[model samples]
Target: MNQPITNAEKLSKLPWSIGSNALVNVFVQLTFLGSVFILFLNTLGLDKSQIGFLLSLVPYTGLIALFIAPLIARYGYKRTFVHFSVLRLLFAALLLLTPWVVSNFGAEATLLFITVVVTLFSITRSIVVTAYYPWAQEYIPKSIQGKYSATNNLFTTLAGFLAVTLAGFVLDLTTGLTGYLVLIIIGVLCGAVAVWGVTKVPGGAPVEVGRGVMASFRDTIAALGDKGLLFFLAGVGLITLATVPLTSFVPLFLQEEVGLSSGNVVLVQTGVLLGGLVSTYLWGWTSDRYGSRPIMLSGICLLALLPIFFMLMPRYSPVSLYVALGIAFLQGIADMGWVIGSTRSLFVSIVPPEKRSEYTALYFACVGVFGGTSQLLAGQVVQLSSGVSGSFYFFVVDAYTPLFLLSIIFAIASLFTLRTVRSDTQVTVEEFAGMFLRGNPLSAMTSLVGYHFAQDESRVVAMTERLGVTRSPFTVDELLEVLADPRFNVRFEAIISIARTRPDPRLTQALIDVFNGTELALSNIAAWALGRVGDQTAIEALRQGLNSKYHSIQANSARALGRLGDAKTAPLLLERLQNEPDIGLQMAYASALGNLRAKEATSPILHLLHDIQNEGARRELALALARLVGDEGHFIHLYREARADFGTATAQAVSAFKRKIEKVLNSETKVLSTLGACADNLARDQLTEGAGYLAQLIEVLPADHYDPH
Candidate 1:
């Protein structure tokens, strides 16, 4: 019996598996997969029906994978994957015989020969896929599976991008069967190297041979009875059905209708792969952090927009290529999200590990059957409506337009079905959508500007200058109109922009309303914005926010109260500081106390500073101490420590510390000037113990930077 594989041993084999997988993907994309392959068939004078039929052969033949799973179980994953992979390479080499077949037997015979070769290749490839997934599950630890999947996708995209780009250039230069044959030769070589890579990976344990074919078939049937699994299958099935027209017909549409050259077609396809390449890591991060459900929903929603973009591309127009390319790039990103999200949902969360091979085979069979049939049906839809045109409202509903419209309907249905997918981790659709939107760079920037700076502060001042230079300002009432915008980020940005210009009572109440809203992140930003507006009426509301249960609300409320500079709230801040054990919350209280210039806080601040060991909390305490004491020593120590830490750290860490130091030294002009004044006083009075440190700090400072007045 084989020794049971530990997680560590499995993890050690991931690099080999991932590398082999990427190499195989490159071979497929370059030779018989992707838009390039469809374009190749088009060049041979194959109609939509023939091209779709050829494309569907791969998935339709994948049904054989259900029976192949048992063979893989007996043979072992590594042995089966490696053996079939080597056989698939020989089938790829047979593509070079296509030109010879056409010369001797005519185009119809050539098509038949090509079909036989591809069918074998497809069936062999499907067996490899069946064995590969279970192998990966055993090899890659679940703890880092999302990250590992992302990395694997990254390699695949990079390889695909390079391979496809080269094939496009070759096809553009040669423009005949010769160029395609050369691509096939290259693909076969890649497959050979990929097989060698696979050989390096550790072979997982084989299943017991005593389990007969009937037993395996029964296992697969039982696995399909799972309701959660059924819902997941339905969701994936809808998406695959929706996208059939896209995968099967879009390349034909682009070349025939959009009138793009082979070079431009490759460029558009490359753009899509580029989009996937860029977003693979981001999708992985999101999947790992938030769970796969939100990523799936977000991807489906984005995918629903692709058909609309496709519909917008005008036939035979110069702009159509650009529009098609843009659509392809966006489609790539959406597709990647779908791939990553669905993989996690299906392999990691939904199916049981013991029966993973059986369930994986079953899942692929469903996709292959449904998705393959959809492609064939879509081909007939195109052929039946070939010359058809009509008006749907003001827009023309052409034959192609109907397919896209059908795709849109199915995409929406997939989104709803995905909501019912049960996973170990659950995120509500609403919360997931909100999190994704709020995490956008524009939204995050707007919130940063709103919460962190006063109206006349330099960052806000610079922003106003840019706004004035580039665009007209919204009138107060116009800004108010935007305050009720549907997107929370939009409304949040509008409220912040309005607060910068005019802090009216109505605007103050609007900010208060947002602060009391259900979106906790937005509510925290609103509280901080209320402080920046400095409305006395809002101060009471801000105080009420301090009593909220959420730590963020309490922290932001403290920071806001400090910005209001209310001496009366000093006692309350001091009490909170004494009780608050969270170091970050303690830092907020310390900053608030300093802003209030509460002398009562001095001893507690010093005590907290001495007791705290967290670097961030220490920096905040030092800044607060400087603000309270008008002492140069605190800032001097902070600056020195930041510099010393910067020297020994990585480049990224150095840059971060440098930014933090600059924010302190520059953003707080009043604090820096006060520190300078205290330094001068101590030096002039010859207070020897403290004066020496002050003088050294002054020597390091730029001249004429501090104005005591």
Candidate 2:
């Protein structure tokens, strides 16, 4: 009795899902997710290692999710998510009691209480999050998932920015644990609003039942067998380890190392959220079409440099605060790509709908293990490096610098794994990186934006034409995207534009798709365009296109094969020429044979020329013969003159024409190019200054075919 949700209904349910995420992001920002919670733990006299374990608890909760996933399958994803969200919030409210416990029970006892409470909250939150992923898979249609990820990030980031800005001032206004109390209270209230929003969104019914613990275990094992999913997880896990530590510790570095106030330290996080707010959508938009692999790799590479930047910042210099803010902002932008790429790669390439719940649980566990371990290690590293401070060459060494350098090394090491992950888009890492570097950035940006938002087919065609004229590699993706337009004119224009660019293998593949597609108009253009842009890879497709029942398609494909000029296809062209009944296709095959330099077809073509009654077909045959023998292209024009009458011409004009043929007959040279033959036979500049040969050419025209008025 399960009914499929129509795409329209799914779209209608999106606002609740995204809006709820935005609200929860505020709660996350104000509470344990960022600076406030870390500073709160630090306020209770807890050292680095103790605070690290607290942060680690978030991921440790994922271990429980491994067991709780089947419950979601039995009860339905949305219900479990809604129910657990409230339960998690109740536990989160216990965080408000931290200062009271610390005031009476001492640091050790307060640490124990906070751990127990946060762990319970984290466990509930993990189950809620595990259910949310499968819920999202159903709630958001595949067509818009890329945009939705970006949109969700955008709104959540704005909410986080606002929350941090508010929390920063609240901490500045009140002293110590009291400010922390206010923030937690606000966070819990926001959490309540977020839980209500989760109830309004639809989908996430139980995918199936009776797939018990053993089946879930098998699914987890089976996921590792998928090379794409495995490699993706490896790349993401390494990156998470590399980047998470820096984000976790940056606030502490600012507060303890650089002399920023608690409020200003919290406000610095706003820079990170602000950077994400600006750039997250861009990462999503590009990765949606360009493939997430580049986005993922590019992000981690950017992140790799940030740790080094942090290592070099002068502690407590006048500009150190500004420097800290800049690095935090840059980290946000770099991390946005990682976030978008990871989320998109999971939905777009890694997990499938049928296995959503189980795979999601595996994802949570994998990320949690990596992230939790990184935080714990980072804290321990901070604790261990406390005595290990000095200057390393030009850099100012501190307890934090070692952790930053460690993050940098791991960030770079993850590159190899990212490269191994497959990309659906054909763009290589070099090409994606070079796209803005080498091309006209404005033109590339304009083309991408115009093509993405283009509603008018005419405007799209115009943009397609302009992009072709730019001949930039960056424009090829947009041009290829246009080839899928439902309107034939738009697709036809895209094919022509693609042909005008430098040869790319993707161009050949895309053209092959259109040539093989059902539309004949696009098929013909795609065939012709393929010959212009395709490599040897395109020969097979063009050859197969010759088998199409439509003469226009066959003719274009044959002509394209000729244009491609691969001599290996000459035999196929000759066979088609000999058997095709259509005069148009016959001409096309003959032309293709000539371009391919198929010397074997010359005699057969001559026989066809002698037998065929059509003038145009015979002309094509003559040209084909000329090409095979390495004669000048102008030989076709000479053949026309010879067929015309010279009976009424003066003796000198007739004599000159006769002399041209006699010289060619006696020439020692075996091959003749067009200009070389023209110079030898006519005036030296006969092709350019036709005035010298105009009289001679006119005199040779048949008296029956020509008359001067």
Candidate 3:
């Protein structure tokens, strides 16, 4: 029999678990560097069509990347990232070569070459970026994906803020060739730094993918065949169509229409990026707490108002221009909903992990087409109207056009799509337990687990417990009906809830009897609940479970024993130290021993942890030993060594370890000591207080060897 899985193990692969903040750094740097080209386009003597042509190259290359993305997938993200980086740097350097080529050759020839360079860069950058996209789904945990990806976008937007402003400032200071060359040189340097960042991001095993490019492309498109995914892709396209015009051509609009100075215009432009950057986490938090659709719909409605606000910008005084920029900032914030909403959770949730990159490429490819076409159309429309300067009262209008109205229409249209984007708001196993503690209807408890509601049947069982009254509102037999429900999550949630809230010992015994036959997920939840409620009466049953041959069951029992705080099982736990073969189990063992405050098992833990296979477990075990021994030297040594190993895997691992150790040391030193001083003999009763210190120590040890008895 297998032991139950712990909460920590279940969420190990989530992006935040892998130090999602690193992505924020990546986004900020890329956006800042990427936006420079947009700011300086007109200064290079490029007309509207010419600038449009340059921007058009990004998608043109994206098309090529679309084809090669699968091939890159074959080699994996790590190699694709490295290759794309080298190409980007080379292309940045290639931009510096542009002026010399144009000076020597004809303008048309030079422009053609510049377009080629942009296209190639765009293609390679696509592979680099898209390759990394799958990792977002792979690395981040499901619970926090929305928040982490949104925060990542927020940081990326800040880069846009600085890039737009500085690009304007640079162009404002230097002449045509000199400014362009300088921006390109800076771009190369940024690209080099970006390369370093990607290399540092640790990679896991590559997913099995289609062997060839065409087959991968086929699979990518096939992913959209899922109705949910199809709507998501459509939503992405519509959102991009609505927003790309604002980002790509807004600089030109601000300059020519508002008649603002270049420096001042850049500041106004910052409104969009800053607003976006500030609002990302809010939208993400909302999505996590609520659902993606409501937040997304709100953003779209807000975006629909941008055209109305644009009409007022020309009427405002210079000081009031700040107000206008503020509106632009609002537009940017609304735009954050689209970017954050479209890219991550919905995409990953609808598709399997193996096919994420392929599906993501299809989504972005459609985005490139729609986004690219909108920018080209906006530019052309502006170019045709550039010559029609109408004097409105005393004000001069350079390009007063109705094109922004199209943007407004697109945004409004997006609201209709929200109705189809459904996710459920249901209580989780954790919340179900909390509900019992309060003695209320669990159904009334607000939850974000609705996304998994339709997929699981046990939810009904859990709901029954939440709704059940002491008078037996529903028959006891109706509760047992939940076990037969085929949906795993539902069964899992129901069994756990029943075990927690129901007082019948026989019911618990029956639940425990059938627990072994349940799915790993549901079984783990049952085990966890059984342990949490301190069902000492079921200790004999739990002890029987510990004797099971299954690794998962054994591990769960180890954890349950710790939670039970039974010194009687200390020897059982200690005996297993030399028998378990799994590193993850060893970590659980260290954690369990620490939880029990089994000071008797300390030397065994310290000795076994020394030869641990996993660095994370070893680090945790060392800290546990320190707690058991009550030595400041152990704390210092653990802190110093763990910090040194922080960069190897996920920075989050290092941070998690540091936080655990510090929390333990701090609590033990302050709160616990004060209580111990006051309680005197009463201090011994606070077993968990000491257990807390040991728990941290055990959790911090390296997980090299786990031997289950």
Whole-model lDDT per candidate: 0.77, 0.79, 0.61
**Per-residue accuracy of model 3 over 5-90 as CA lDDT, tens digit each:** 34354354333422333433333233222344565556556788777767766654555546766666667766776776687667
Better of 2 and 3 by TM-score: 2
Residue ranges of candidate 1 with Cα displaced over 4 Å = 390-396, 439-709
Task: Name the 10 consecutive residues with the lowest summed lDDT in model 1.
Answer: 465-474
Residues 1-709 of candidate 1: C-alpha lDDT, one tens digit per residue:
6777777877787888788878888789867787767777877878778877888888887787777788888889888888899999998888888878888999999889879988999989888888887877777788887888899999988888888888888888996788788888888898899899988777556787567777887878788788888899888889988986687688777776678887678768887888899889778866876788888888898899998887667778878878887888899899899898889877777878988888898888888887778878788788787897766654556778778888999999999998888864666657656544432444433433443353444544444332222222223334455567565655666656655653566678878888898989778888888888788888888888888989899999999998898778889999988888887788889999987877678888989999988887887787787777666464665577546553222233324433554664786554455344444444344345334444554565555654431
Candidate 2 residue-wise lDDT, 1-709, digit = tens: 7898899888887888888999999887777788988888888888999888889999877876677788787889988988888898888888888768878998789989999998897888888888888888887887776788889989999999999999999999998688988888899899899989878887778766677877777777677888877877787788878887877888898888887888989998988898888888778877887888788777888899997888788777888778888988988898898888878778877888778877888888888989899999999999999887788798878898889888877887788887887666776667778866654656766777777777898988888887776767767777777877878788888889888877777777898888898877788888888888757788888878778888898889888888888677777777877787877887788888888777777766777788888776776777777787667555755665545632222223434554664565445232222223334444332333433344444454345543221
lDDT of 1 at 107: 91
- What is the C-alpha RMSD, rounded to one decimal, of candidate 1? 17.4
Model 3 misplaced regions, further than 4 Å: 1-35, 315-317, 387-400, 424-709
Model 1 clashing residue pairs (backbone): none
The local distance difference test score of model 2 is: 0.79
Which 10-residue window of candidate 3 scores lowest in summed lDDT? 443-452
Minimum summed lDDT over a 10-residue window in model 2 is located at: 668-677
lDDT of 3: 0.61
| Runs with alpha carbons beyond 4 Å of true place in candidate 2 | 211-232, 421-427, 456-462, 469-474, 481-502, 505-709
Winning model by lDDT: 2
Report the error of model 1 at residue 126, Å.
1.3
